[model samples]
Target: MKTFTIKDNVKKFLTVLFWILIWQVVSLFTEEILFVSPFKVLPKIFENLGDLNFYQNLLSTVLKVSWGFILGLIAALFLGGLSYRFKVFQELISPLILFLKSVPVVSFIMLAWLFLSPQGIPVLISFIIVVPIVYLNFYEGLSRVDKSYLNMAEVFNVGLWKKVEYIYLPSVRGYLLSAVELSIGMAWKSGLAAEVITFPEFGLGALIYNSKLYLDTVNLFAYTIMAVVSCYILEKGVLYIIRRILK
Candidate 1:
């Protein structure tokens, strides 16, 4: 076990080092102000880390996106349940889900900006991106439930809670987690994109736009890194909480 762990760590370290080396070589060859080295960007990111406004912006964006994600998840679960119980609801909403899936993100951002306050745009965008994903995954999960277990439940006259706990939940766990992971990334991306277009007061998207306007490549890269890291941390944290609860 120790040997395997050590080997895995070594492999990951080597992989990261290889990519860093490639980046360094590319930066050296380009010698462009727009493509600053990773070292330069790292310091800028650290400097920004000290700013109070940075945390405020990060927290605000997180709150908006998280709220949106939660709302969408609940709606999806409710709607998916309804769809599972009734063929009529499923047929009615199928086209709407398809339309949401087909529409462009920028179009949604633009349309939402016209109707929603700047602060609301991110939440709306996050919801738009997350809903269809959760709906589809949950619907599939419901459809894939073992008929044998359902039949057994019916035969035994299982209560709603028991059926949910022992049958539906266990069957849907994988789908729920998978949808959540995918939606986390999508929510962040769509939310930030909406913020950038709307120029929300305190958002990572606004920071990135400002950086670009001034041609601050280092800060641009730093903000991009921060956004990616934030998304990753949120995704892992949510997944951990879900796993703990389910366990």
Candidate 2:
């Protein structure tokens, strides 16, 4: 087990190093203003870590997006449960779900900007981005639940809570996790894009926008890397928490 783990870590490290080398080589030939090298951009991540404004932006974006994700998750579960219970309800919402799935994210952001406050834009956008994924994936999982298990539960006169706890939840766990994993990155990207357009008081997107305004490629690259790292950490951390809770 330990040997396999070590090998996996080494493989991941080598993959990252290989990409960084490619990035470095490309930056060497590109205009410095347009493409900052990883060598220069990476240090800025450390520098930003020490800056108070970085935290403020990070916190604001995190809070806003979290609200979006939580709300969207709750709504998805509720609606998904309803859809699972009633074929009619699923049919009723099918068109709307299809519309959401087909619509460009930018259109949602732009339309939302007109109605939602600057602070609410990211949250709404994130929520919009998350709902369809959660609903569809969760519904699919719910639909595929083993009939034998449900029949056994019925035969045994299992209570609603027990059936949910022992049967339904376990069946849907993979689907729920899959939805969450896919939606996290989209939520962040949409939320941040909304922020870039709306320029909320304190947000990483605001910082990125400012960097663009000043032609600061190093800061832009640093912030982009920060966002990517943050997304990865968020994905892993949330999955860890979910696993622990489920266990």
Candidate 3:
């Protein structure tokens, strides 16, 4: 297993290196003003990393998106549970869920900007993108709970908590975890897109926007790398927590 893992890691590194080489070749061929070599971009990224404000901006962006994501997840779970329990409520909410899922993120961001402050836009956008996903996944999971297991629970006169623990929860754990993983990436992407458009004072999105305004290709690439890295780290962290809880 150890040998296989090591080989896998090496393969992944080689794949990444191969892509970077391809990118370098493409940039060289284009010789365009907007394109910066990955090597040059890496040094600029490191330079930005040394700045204290870089960390602050990264942290602030993460916090805003995460706060909205958690709140949205809680709201989704509550509503999904209620919908599962009540047929009328489900009927009423189904359209709204469908509408939210269908609307473009940019449309939501633009509409939200009218009523919300710049700082609030990212949170709202993140919430809008995440909530529907969670609601749908949880609702489906709840509905798909095995009838036999429920009947068995009834026969055993299992308490509400035990029924949830042994039946409902385990059945839904995979769905819930998948929803979380999917929403984390969506929240980050939508939130950052909101920041770029809204130009919040301290955010990765704002950094990207400013880089664009100045025609700073290296800075733009650096900020893009930062956003991607942040998203990757956040997803891994959320998955780690999910694993711990399921364990």
Residue 195 CA displacement from its true place in model 3, Å? 0.2
Off by over 4 Å in 1: none
The CA lDDT at 219 in model 1 is 87
lDDT of 1 by residue, 1-247 (tens): 9999999999999998898788888889775566889888888889999999999999989999999999998898998999999999999999989988899999998898788999999998899888999999999999999999999999999999898889998988899899999998999999988888888899999998898889888888899999999999999998888777655
Quote model 2's TM-score: 0.96
* lDDT of the structure predicted as candidate 2: 0.90
lDDT of 3 by residue, 181-246 (tens): 999999999999999999989999999999999998889998998899989999999889877876
Q: Best to worst by lDDT, what's the order? A: 3, 1, 2
Every candidate's lDDT: 0.90, 0.90, 0.92
> Ten consecutive residues with minimal summed lDDT in candidate 2?
238-247
Clashes of 3: 0
Model 2: lDDT of residue 154: 92
Can you give the lDDT of residue 5 in candidate 3? Answer: 100
lDDT tens digits, residue span 164-230, model 2: 8888889889998999888888899889999899998889999999999999999999998898888
Model 3: colliding residue pairs:
none
